[model samples]
Target: MWCFDNQKLHMNMAILETQSEGGNIRDSLLLTCQSSSNLIFGIQPKQEPLIRSLSESELRQMPKERFNQNEFSSIKLSKDLKIRKEDIILYNRESGILRDSLEKDELLTKSEKERRKTNREKFKRALRVERLHFLLPKKEKNLKPQPALKIDWSKSKIKTNPDIIKVLKSFYTNRRDPQFPTGNQKLLLEKLAPFPIFSVENNLRQIILAYPPETYMKNLSDKLYDYYYRLYEWESDTRATSIGFFFFNPEDALMYESTIWKYGSLSAAELGTRLSFFRFSTAYKLNRTSPPEIRFLFIPDVKEVGDLVTRYRYQYGKQMKFHPNQKITRDGFADQPIYTIENVQLKQGLFSRREVSYFGELKDHKYIFFTVDGAESAWNKFRQANPNLRLPRRPNLLVYNFNSFINDCEMDPDLINQNFIFMLNREAYKALDKSKQDTPKVSDFSIFIDNRVKPQLFLIKIWAKRLKLVLFHAPRINEFPRREALLDGLTNFFPPSLYRVK
Candidate 1:
């Protein structure tokens, strides 16, 4: 084999010679030697051929030298070098280069050499930037910006239990319900099973309708709580739920979408605690006797609401059916189809948190195809009926336009098939995206769905950690009170003693 040994070359050969009876030249000669890397051969014993040393240029003509002359040159340097042409041809292989049918022994041009040099320079610059901007600073703690979130009452279009209404009024007004009045002086909220002031307009009939299903509102409250505890000091501040709430300043609204106002740090537990507060399949409680406070509060981004709703429908609407008798059920002859309880499965299933979210399976796809307007309306109704019983108000309200979503689905994967979060405005999401882009090296949450693990289960765990609300939608029915319902409900209701507020 051709190789550099002490920067020299050598060869081995066997030959048959007869002591001359008289001085006479032989008829032929036998040669043996290595051809190239990983090859060796000798002339056949019976086939004696003429052999002679080759000049440097002549040796360069050999096939082995045509590709890697530097390697084959080592062989030529040896006085002992020897080989048979047949064996050399048998071991020949191209040196990963092509030049028509015949091989050539030529060096690459200077331009090709320069191109490689340029690539190496680019690599060094990239390495330097990466070290300074990412690797070096990763160990340093990140600074958090001040927290800003919006909190307010929104119009509801579904039935609300009298007790929950009383609780909300008490919390909002900081006062108990009024004493009995002689006439119709804002009849006691307790007397109304469902309040009318919060009604919404149905896109189809344009009629003021009651709120969504009971469970829907309950899930909404769960989302609020999920968001509420995202603060770093929430647990220490509020021993009851360990969640903190911050309101957005009026001045901040104008610049809400800016990156300067969006980034902050709160413990992962804070978000998890909030998500654990709802009625996920059932409910889950944190194991600690005194859990950490949650960091909650962030501005809402309304522009993203449609995206959030589309995701909700994809996860829960696939198997639902609308019944005509139900409030959300549609009447004959319209551009949109209505959904109701009759044709849906009202089962309590885990949607996000460990606690189960209340959901129903629809029996028809026609209802879903009508549009997101109808889906939004039906979701409102769905929320009103299920009244998760544990949570206090409607889950976060998400309005969507189906036609717009389907048309734009190809542009954004999150808008079409994944779980989404709603912000009060567009700026919040923009700020988040910018922060992530600026620090491209950060690791993100991911899930692997396989035989032993489900993607939804991982999503639930992550949702809890982020203190984010989730909604699932599908072809037939839309799932409500997502991850918030599961994690928050379980965490809030767990260990019973924590329920006894200090």
Candidate 2:
């Protein structure tokens, strides 16, 4: 067995020695010491480590060296200094270099040199911007912003409930009847649009959809509030604003995504981003409270939509889902079948904010063969149905032969076998050459399942103006008048408190 002497550990070099056996030396070696206990064979066994808090002055002595060592390629160290192989590995990681500095080191052979370095530079910049924020003068008290006044219908008196009901009918996106509307789509929107919207196309489809049976939310207390992404307050003056909060956990992350718009003091990047820009599974709020501000917002990019009428069919057309990992994505029609949903438990990552997301089994999955037209159509429908529901911005009307996304990626829509996301991954895998390994894994190709949205705090926005609206529509509110009344309450932000969202 080997043992380390009681001599002080050096920043540059440390001596590793075997147990004492007479005066003859068995083996002796010099190794670099690092913060991690990788090179050390043993610690001094007889005495406690003299750990104590450093004084404030001593703590202020920050290291002068910026992280700039590249261990990937061979480099000679100068006489004045020595850096740990871990620091060299970190430098290569930060700069997107793949080779490990200490891969040759016999001692560091067991050390984990591989690390995730995606967007390292971007994160460092974000960190710098945040640190600078602390030095700026603290925000003034009560600098709460007011909600942007899109309408002042509050001034005029409503003559009757039917008048308000008429307005509610216009905003309603969910229509239970399967029959497609008979009139021209544009004409219908022009006649029915309550607010002065910029444009319209096919009115958005509205239908009740079942949540996965394995929902974690079902066990939560009935008093739980449905989460939302709301445009609470629009900024006015930038001089002074309300103090905002930072999120440290999953629960508060839900609060951040729910805060949709920019406000005083808060950067636009901090607020909930638009659905198209969002990388996470847009956690759709079954119990909505926001005023229906948008109509069918056209999703730019993908190809034109044709009618889909096969397996996994919904009200308008069939929908498909693709799993990101743990099994290879497939068309599900071949002899080489993917794992069945019953056997495969879908993991809702912690990033999904478990308190607000659906986990359990990936439910109601059905497949279609690879086709260019169908893939394009499904991609459009999936994005429309899923993403925008979480953070809808401007109303993008119907789709034409839009090709910004698919063309940009140069992906052949026909190769897409599973859902739009899965198809993208499959296409990318095909694009890569099998130079590294005989069997390429998902990580080999530069492909990604969508990353989850981080939780954020929307304290500043919620604290400002009389901008609350209860998105009271849910599967549980079955009766007609009660549903209508809930809609009526959500139709205006400044309206009197009328009904609970539940």
In terms of lDDT, the best-performing candidate is 1
The TM-score leader among the candidates is 2
For model 2, residues 345-430, the per-residue Cα lDDT tens digits are 22357555222121122333232222333344444454465563342221111211211222222333332232221222232222
Model 1, TM vs. native:
0.14
Q: How high a TM-score does candidate 2 get?
A: 0.16
Q: What lDDT tens digits, residue by residue, belong to model 1 across residues 1-502?
A: 0011111112332222222334331111123333232211111234233344223343222111012222122122123534321111111122222432221223434664465446434433322111101100011125221111111112111222234554454433312113222122122112222211111111111111111111122345444543333221121321112222111121232222111111111212222111001111111111111123322222222223333334443544534332332222122221112122222233356653333243435322123222333344555666677666343222322223322332233244443223221112223234334435553442223212221144356556666644434323222244344434434544322111010000
Off by over 4 Å in 1: 1-242, 245-429, 442-502
